[model samples]
Target: MNTYLRILSYARPYSRFVPVYIVYTLMAIIFGLLNFTLLKPLFDVIFEQVDSEVLLSYQNKPDFTFSIDYFTHLFNYYFLQVAEEYGKMGTLFYVCLIIVVSVFLANLFTYLSGVVLAKVRAVVIKRMRTDIFDQVSRLHIGYFSSERKGDLMSKMTNDVQEVENTIVQSLRVVFREPATIILYFAVLFFMSVKLTLFTILIIPISGAIIGGITRRLKKKAVESQQSLGRIVNILDETLGGMRVIKAFNAEWFMARKFDEETDHYAAVNVNMARKNELASPISQFLGVTVVAGILVYGGSLVLSGESTLGASDFITYIIIFTQVLNPAKEISRAVSNIQRGIASADRIFQVIDTKSKITDPDTPLAFDSFQKEIKFEQVSFGYEDEMVIKEVSFTLSKGKTIALVGPSGGGKSTLADLVPRFYDPTHGIISIDGHDLKELSLADLRKHMGIVTQESILFNDTVFNNIAFGMDEVSEEDVMEAAKIANAHGFISEMEHGYQTNIGERGAKLSGGQKQRLSIARAILKNPAILILDEATSALDSESELLVQEALTKLMQNRTTLVIAHRLSTIQHADEILVVEKGRIIQRGTHTDLMQQEGMYQKLSSIQSV
Candidate 1:
């Protein structure tokens, strides 16, 4: 219930809707009760059973004031006039007409109250979705690495949908049902004090029983939502890795995996349904038992001449008491459904409440442009306890290229990530133009650098939009010029939509070369002062490499570069080359200088030269 209220709290400043909704709900309740309450008088008028003493009491018009009885007395006064002026059949016609109007007004106000709740529902979902999405966006890159994309996707899409459909829709039952039960019970008590007290005795037993059924519901709900998330995860993986699955002939494997999750989900839901579906019937059966008891007890009191109710009044009392059971049954069902919604709500808040490890300093240093160099002084980093990058010191000076060439499992990519403050070093300092990386705002620091990795991270967007991604003030001419420099403009022009052509997911519509070139064009569009190329041309064929290498050469001119090269020939002319092995720089020198040394660099260079 606390979780339910918290979800609703997203719609703040209740002044806009709460007061108006209350007014509508109250009016609806008043008119609906009037429809049932008039049955006694309706019976009397139809049977012509009004005694002279009772009719005389209503002869004088009751004065109106701020009380429930004022309306009742005023109504009876007019009813007496109708009985006197018209015949019994005419009075019966008048009572039925009053009931028809009351029913109409009741339904009209109920709809208005539902409209107010709908407005609250819309605002609540909009704000909650916006907040969760914003929180995900603010999380650091590491968070994505540690969490499953499918689970996060489920929280954003499926979990939010459940909250809206189940919990938000239950708002009427939460407010209106209780108010209805209270109002009905008040009328029942007014009708017979002894009978109402007997009925009230069954409440605690009903509450305890309903509470027991819903208690297990929350645990089952959490399990079911989690199982659904796993199913989605499997589906996502199967779709993304379909080629691998087919090549390995693992169709049966994936199918079995999917079946296991779905089977578990089915079982969980079936068990939950058993308990949830039982609540209403139990409440109804208990209500009927009470009604039977009331028949024996209350009817005996009237028959023995101890009770004040006439035959018609006693019957009306039973009718109003039966109405109370509907709202009670509705509340029981609402509690069952709400347990599931709160489980989903907990998943959503879990993501929204996570704190990002990477954030700007309280007093961040202003960094507008690159100067002298990027210096790594005794810098080391690791994941958990095992170090990935040992103490590696290097300087990438202005307008010079510093290349890192090494075998696989070396800390090449991790070293490049440090420059953008993607992850801070575990020990020592990485300074840009003498400012510690931590002191500078991440956006300001990254603005001067552009990175292109081995895998071209292209989105399912138009070629123009992909090239101009994350960059502002770029005109069409700018995108075209960047593409031309990266050797992508020719193919783009030949395509059906030119720059507007949609590159399917990860540029699947284009060849590997075309995708790499498009990614290069994006880097060229940024035109940063510092460039980090991590084996950008390694994945391309010889023909594609020549074109992309030429583009890289043009991009490298007059810029500080940190290059992680796989091909030895590509970095032969670098200002300095650091040959890394097992997270250590084992050899360092220029192309000609390293060729003279008898070490790992010479061995690697000799093998490639062969």
Candidate 2:
């Protein structure tokens, strides 16, 4: 319930509509009661037992509003006069007409209330989804490392829809069913408190039972929702890596894994459903018991002549008591639904409550230029338990290219990530132009750096948009110029739609080398002072590599470049080359100097040459 209240806070801006909805809902309930109330009098007149003196007293006896008083007085007066002249049968015909009119009005207002609720719920769903998406986007990259894509998708889609259903349905229950119960209770009490009180005894006992069931339902619902997320996660993983599974011929293995997860989800749902389904029959059975008790107890009173239970009043009382069954059943069902909704809300808000690990400073530094050298002094770092870089140090003087040659787990990429502040160094400091990297604003620090990684990620957007991705707005000429630098312009222009072509999902429509070139073009468009290339030509063929390498050489000529290269030939001409081994710089100098040293670099170059 607390989780739901937190979610409902999203509706604060639309508070005005809530009051309007509440009022209409209450009016609808009132109209329903009025429709029922007319039945007693209508039945009385029909039996020909309604005396004129009693009818006259009811007409004149009101310290209520003038309209209500006038209507009561006029209705009774006309009814008695008509009853005397036209007989009981004619009064019955008029009574049925009045009921039909009341029923029509009641349904009209109920429909209006539904419309209002739908509009409010749509706005709430939209707002909640947008907030969740925005929050996920701002979360640190580390959060994604252990998180399942499918679980996140489930939260965004299935969980949100559940919450929307809960909100709208719960609002309806709160406004309608409870009001129905209250209105009927008041009418029954006015009819006879002794009878009403006896029926009302079911309220507390039923509430306690419903309360206990709802608590367990909330717990079960949370478990079921979590299991659903797990199932979604399994499906996401299977689909994302289906190519690998097929290559490995592990279809049976994957099927078994999926079945295991789905079975868990099924068990959880069965438990949740069993608990939720308990609400209806349990409440109804109890209601029936209460009704039977009333029949026995109230029947004794009437037989003993201790109470005035007229045939018409007794009939009306029974009608009102039976109506109580609907409210009880509805409310009992609503409690379970509310519990499920709250469980989902709890999951959603858990995501919303997570504060991003990285955030901008209060007074951020503004820098439009990288005027001096990039320096790392005794930099040490770890990803949690394992130290990846130890006492590592380097200096990239302005306008020089440094190549890092290392084995697969030699912390080369980790060092590269620190430059862009993807993860800050665990110990020691990195500086740019004599200013600590942390002191400068994140936007300012990253703005001057261009990075092209091994995996060239591109969106399902036009070629021109992909090329000009980093800039706020770029001219066609500027996009073309960047493409030409990456040697992608020739191929792009030859495509069917040229730059306007929509690249399919994750640029799957393009060849691997073409995708890399587009990423290069995007970086080129940014025109950063510092460039970092992590195996930029690893995926390119010999022919594409030649063109991209030449473009890259020209791009690196006047910029401070850090190249993490696997192919020794790519970085033989670098101003300096460092051989990293086991998180330390074991050897450093120009390529020729490192080769003569007969160390890790020499062995790596020999292996590549062979």
Estimated TM-score per prediction? 0.97, 0.93
Summarize candidate 1's per-residue lDDT along 1-610 as a digit string, tens digits.
5787789798788899899999999999989999999999998866767887977888888776987688777888888888788968778888999999999999999999999999999999999899999999988887888888888888898899989988998999978999999999888877888888988886668878998999999999999889888988999999999999999999999999999999999999999999999999998988898788888889999899888888888999999988888988888999999999999999999999899877899999888888799999999998779899999999889999999998998999889989998888999899989999999988899899899999999999999999999988889999999999998899999999999999998899998889989988999999999999999999999999999999899888888999999999999989999999888899999989998989988888788879
- Candidate 1 lDDT score relative to the true structure: 0.91
Off by over 4 Å in 2: 58-90
Q: Which residue pairs in candidate 2 have backbone atoms (N, alpha carbon, C) closer than 3 angstroms, thus clashing?
A: none
By summed lDDT, the worst window of 10 consecutive residues in model 2 runs over: 59-68
What's the residue-level lDDT of 200 in candidate 1? 88
RMSD per candidate (Å) reads 1.6, 2.4
1-610 per-residue lDDT for model 2 (tens digits)? 5676677677667675787888778777777777777878887876756866686675443454666456667677666666667778777877777788888878878888888888778777888999999999988776787688888888888889889887556777876887888878877887788988877776689778877887898887788788788888878778778899999999999899889888887888888888788888889888888888887888788778876787777777877788878987888888889888888888888888888765676776667799989899999988779899999989999999999989999999888988877777888889898877877888888989999988889999999999888688689999999899888999999999999999987898898889988988888899989999999887788987888788788678788999999899999989999888889999999988988887898898888889
Per-model tally of clashing residue pairs: 0, 0
Report the lDDT of model 2 for residue 394: 90
lDDT per prediction? 0.91, 0.83
